[model samples]
Target chain A: MKKKFQNSKTETVVYFICSLVGLLIVWQLAVSFTSLQKVMPSPFVVLGFIGQSLTQKIGGKILPLHILASLKRVFVGYFLACIIGIPLGILMGCSKTGKAIVKPIFELLRPIPGLAWIPLAILWFGIGETSKYFIICVSAIVSIILNAYAGASQVDQTLVGAARMLGAKPAQIFLYITLPASVPQIFAGLQVGLSSSWMAVIAAEMIRANEGAGWIITTGMESGNTVQILAGMISIGLVGLLLASLLRLIERGLCSWNIQGR
Target chain B: MSKVEVNHLTKSFGSLKVLDDISFQVNDGDFLCIVGPTGCGKTTFLNSLVKLYDIDDGEILINGEEVDLNKHSIAYIMQEYSTMSWLTVKENIQFGMKVRKFSKEKLNRKTEEVLKMVGLEKFADYYPEQLSASMLQRVSIARAFAVEPDLLLMDEPYGQLDLELRFRLEDELIRIWQETKTTIVFITHNIEEAVYMSQRIMVLTNKPTKVKEDFVNPLPLPRNVTEEKFIEMRNKVTNLIKWW
Candidate 1:
């Protein structure tokens, strides 16, 4: 089993490198054969643009503006979701009344894409950062609530019975047995929610924004700069990848003793 | 004083009656084993005493007081592996003591004492999954003892072990019983084990189960299982349990 795991790790690393090389080859071919380079630009062209920008300052600003803007949007929306979703998920999982009340509302609203919420969000929170924040918040909250609920409810009933028989009270049982048991599941939900919100609501930002990576793309496209557009796209993908990796690390850290190996 | 008394006890599941008018007594410091065939309500009776299941009829008393079944402190070690999976052997053992609001110094001392008693002092850091089935059983036994419980209820505690490990655990149990002198009401399907462990054996009939036979074990302590008297007593109880 240990050898299998090591071999798989090596395979994945090699696969990632091969895929990057493959994409570069395709981009080079596209630049030579088609109009895609005129629109999307070649990978080398975009890398050259970013390299030039590394030394030259643009309007007394550097790369951090776009990076910081995107980071702030993610943190604000994600933090709000965490504060509201976790406890609510636990309650809904444990109580019939809570599930009965919350399930209907979630089902009705959950299917609507985050981008679709832009019109109402603009109306409600105005054409500001709040609208983008609302989009990400909506995108993440349902998964957190659902996963947390499932985790808390899925606790071993026998353990609850055993604890109660051992003289633990209702509150004590929840604190000692149920809550601790549900943690692995809760982490799973948070990972899913975090990654989804990171990737999904960035599209909402593209619809209308003065800042953010999504806005960076729109600005480059309007200015007819393919290299800048490609850089913006790459920025989005890189940030999403970094955030996803961070979440995976957190999941492993928090759920080290979880029953499932993953 | 009789630490436990079951009076005219009756319990049924739906239309099927599991126990019928069962009664027994265990004196303080006595090791009483209740043995019968499979599905003779041995577990149901034990569960009823702990009030894990609501009784259909009758009452159980602990030392002349009607056991406020909800309020009494009883340690129950089930046959199946149900120890908290995340907790280490030491933490599992200390659970009851923590629940009972024992002081940290007292909890530490009792944990150390019980870990030594189960010969699991070295395995205290192991999780339930890391330990063997017999070792897990020992942790369960240790948890039950850590509480310094007045009434200890065990349901086939050694039923999951290999023959050699089973005998070793039986001897371990006897050692703990002697040291703590806690009143134990053990339920098992093994008649030989019943004879080997108890001062009194209650043989239960098929459900709606009732006490079919009761025998006092007159054999001496540290009794040899290979002795002629031990074999004769085991055969007698085994015959009493046999049915078509």
Candidate 2:
């Protein structure tokens, strides 16, 4: 089993490299040999644009600073969602009255996408960072709350009974058994919430932001520079990948006893 | 004073009556096994004793007073593996002691004692998912014993194990019971296991469960299953349990 795991790790790296190379080769060939190059620049041109944007200003701020601005909005909104949503979810899951009071409203609003909330967010908080944060928070909180509720509600009753037999009070059972049991599921919610947060940030920034990744892309489209547009998109993709990987690392660290962690 | 007495216990689930006027007593340090037919509400009876389910009538007294879980030290091992998955084997064993608020020194001592008793000292750091079925059962048993519970209730804890593993665990249970001298009320559908493990066997009727008979075991400890006396006693209990 250990050897199989090690082999799979090596295989993943090999496969990832091969697929990336395959994509770049196909892209380069399409640009060199086909009329597709009329609208789409070569991979080298886009790569050079990204390289230059690292130091040069896209909208009065360098690429890293633009990325940072968008990230700050995501972090604020995502953290707020986590703080409020997780507790509210757990409360709803563990108590009948809590579920009754909160569930209907949550379900009604659940289907509304983060981007759909943009107009309302702007109407309520205007085009400032607060509106951007509101959009991200609304988008991210849904999954965070849902996952936490599922985790808390799905706790095995048998363990709860065993804890009771071992002389645990209700509070002790919740603290020792219910809380630990719900952690893996809460992490699952966090992963989904993070992706939604990233998605919402781009849409939020696109509304009126002057110096963010979303603004860079919107401005690039206006200026008719496909290379800059592709560069901004590429940065979003890279940063999203890094955020997911970082969240996974934290999950594994906290849930080392879980099979996924192992 | 550790004696448990149940008087005319009756419990019903809405329209269905599961337990009907059951009555029994378990003396201190006595290993009492209750054998009943399948779906005879053996688990319901155990749950009622632990106050997991409220009874419709009668009373359960641990000594001279009513059974209060908070006042009495009790432990239970369910049919399913109840080891906390997020905790390592050592931590799982310590959980009950921690809940009971044992001193740090006594907690460490009891943990060491139970782990060694169950032969799980080396695998102390392994999680429940990493351990095999037999090892998980051992962890549950160790966790139950770490608190030095006054009354230990086991509801067919070995029901999931294979025959060979079941016998090994049964012996391990006997060793622990003899050492701790704790009052035990074990429920099982397996008549042979009831006869093999218990000092006294209480047989219950099929639905609306009632005690059919309670017989003291005449066979000696270190019982051999193939022995004529053991087989006779096993067959006697098996016949008493005939419902289907």
Candidate 3:
């Protein structure tokens, strides 16, 4: 059974690589052989530009530096979201009063996209890194809080009862049972929140920034440089994929028991 | 080990009463199985004993005073395998002891002993999800036994397992009980299991549950189910619980 599982996993990775290569081939062929090149750059051109931009400057900064700036923004916003949202979510799920107090306002704000806060963020914090961080934080905090609440609320009451009967005090029960039980859900929230943070940072940077991936795209658009635009977009896609994979690796470490056949 | 005295315990949800003025006593280190018809509030009775549910009337005393979990060592195994899914088998076994602040030396010793008792020492590093249903149940059993509680309340902990596995686990439970001599109040709908495992049997009536009878089992240890007296006692308890 273990061998079969490992074989399937290897097969899946191979298939994934094949599919991505096939998509790139199709994209490259469509641009080279058709009128599509009039509007879109070939995948090869975009790929070459991305490789060159790693060392060469795109907008006074190398691609790596621009990507690094965006990453730093995402890190700050995501960290703040986790520290605030996790505890708030657990409080809402664990305490009726906490839920009653925080849930309505959270629900009201939940549907408003993080980009929607860009204007207000600029107005409040003045078109600076702080405002960008605020927008990203807003974008990420919703999913973080929601998932945390779900995780905490959905904790198996039986386990809590078992813990209580085993001489776990209320605090101990919350620490050992509630917190651990909510980990997978919290991680799920973190994943979504992270994606949202990336999206928010790009948008925030697009509105007004000299450095970052979003600025690369906006600058490309202004100069009508389709290759640069495509390169920036691909860079964002690759970085987002890398970040998500990193998150999953961390989750696998913390929540190995949740994964089957491990 | 601890003595349990439940006096005139009554509980209700809205207007429907579940446990109605039920009373019972369990001596220290005694194995008592509570058997009743479905929906007869057997679980509610167990919950009340552990103060998981507030009794609308009457009291439960451990030794002499009110049952306080802080003062008394207790462990409960529910019908569901309440193994912590995040912990390995060994860690799950250590959970109760860690919560109760058992010394590290004692916790390590008890964990190893209970893991071996349940024959799960091999799967000590395995998570609950990787184990089969019976193995998961054994993890729960090991966790409960690791505490070496003054009282162990089990509500049909083996209800989900197949008969063969259930019989095997039942024998394991009996061996552990005999070795540790922990006071146990086990609730099960299985008459044969109750008769086989308990030194005394308490049969309860259907809803608005009252104790129909509480009597000692005269059967010897390492009993054979096919034995004449064993079947007689099993049938006797079955007859008492038969609502139909």
Candidate 4:
């Protein structure tokens, strides 16, 4: 059993490496064999650009600094969404009046994507940090609210009844039963919300930013530097993977009892 | 005394009356099992006692006062396992005591005691999903017992368990009752189980439900299901509400 487990772990790393090597091989072959090489850089060129960007400036800052700048916007906006959306969603879910008052307004805004709000966000907040933050918040808050509302509203009635029978008061029931029961779902919301925040940051940065991965891509386009754009894309993908893994680790710690967490 | 009194209890869902003026009383520490035909509103009767449903006419009193869930210390085990899925076996057992604001020392003691009683000490950290059906039912029972309730209501708590596990849990339940002397009102469709577990058996008729028989169980403790006297009592109760 131990051997089998160890084998699967090693197999996962091996498979990941094989897929990346396969993709690189195909890219290199395409560059060598096709005229499309004029439009796109070879795999080696992009890799070299990424390595160079680690130490040298791309637009005005190094690649890591650019990635950090984008991450900061996501943190601020996503944190705001969590604080505001979670409580609002729970209130809407738990109270009939709250649902009636807030649900219609939320539904109206929900269908409009966060990227779609870029123009209005710029108009409202004047292309500043506030507008960018607003876009990320708008993108992320919907999923947060939806998941929190689902978690709170769909709590098992039997558990509530059991709590009441055990002499829990209204407030005690909410705190001990309702809140804990809703946690796994709240984490689910946060996961989606985090990804949304990340995406919104990229879109926001693309429009107007002096230092961010998105700025690297847009400026690369202006200067016709495919290597810079590919490097920026690669960094975004890596950072997104890291952020998601971190959230999953936090979820496992918070909701260890949850089946999904395990 | 932890007596439960139901007087003139009547409940209706729209036009269909499920329970009609049903009334009974259970004395302190009495193990009274309520048996009825399938779909004869047995669960609705239990729900009425818990005030989960509003009865059109009746009063359910615990020790001479109207049933106030918050004030009264009562533990109920429903047909479903009702073990909180998010909680471990230990936490599920402690759930009631924690809700009642038992002191930390008391909570720890009660949780340990009940976990041992249910034979789930080793599985204390195991989630409900990891447990078997019988184990889940045991967890529910342990949770109810941990509360040290004045009144315990169970609605076919072992309904999903197989016959052997059901018999085992029934015996375990009797042992707990004998030790604690907590007033228990158990509801079941199994006449044999009712005969095996109760000091008295109350039979209900088809809906609108009413008491068909309320009499003492003549069988002795540590009841042998195959014993002639036990079979006789079980058959008598079976005949009382046999829909088939």
Best by TM-score: 2
Of the candidates numbered 1 and 4, which has the greater TM-score value?
4
Roughly what TM-score does model 1 have, to 2 decimal places? 0.86
Which residue pairs clash within candidate 2?
none
Name the better of 1 and 2 by DockQ.
2
> What would the per-residue lDDT of candidate 2 be over residues A104-219, giving only the tens digit for each residue?
99999899988898899889998899999999999999999999999999999999999999889999999998898999999999999999998888889887989888888889
Over A113-145, each residue of candidate 4 has an lDDT whose tens digit, in order, gives 999988888888997899888999999999999
For candidate 1, write residues A16-58 as lDDT tens digits.
Answer: 9999899999989988799875656678878887676656643
C-alpha DockQ for predicted model 3: 0.78
lDDT of 3 by residue, A112-221 (tens): 99899988888899988999899999999999999999999999988988888888889998988999899999989999999999888889897689999889988899
Clashing pairs in 1: none
What's the C-alpha lDDT at position B134 in model 4? 85
Worst 10 residues of 2 chain B by lDDT: B159-168
lDDT accuracy of residue A94 in candidate 1: 90
Encode model 4's per-residue lDDT on B15-106: one tens digit a residue: 99999998889999999999988888988988889888889998999999999998888999988767888789998888888777899999
List TM-scores of chain B, every candidate: 0.93, 0.93, 0.94, 0.94
Interface RMSD of each: 2.0, 0.7, 1.0, 1.2
**Candidate 3 segments exceeding 4 Å error:** A260-262, B162-181, B220-222
Judged by DockQ cut-offs, the docking class of candidate 4 is medium
Q: Report the C-alpha lDDT of model 3 over B71-142, residue by residue, as the tens digit.
A: 898888888778899989998889888877899999999988888877788999988888998888888888
Question: Could you tell me how far off, in angstroms, the CA of residue A24 lies in candidate 1 after the best superposition?
Answer: 5.2
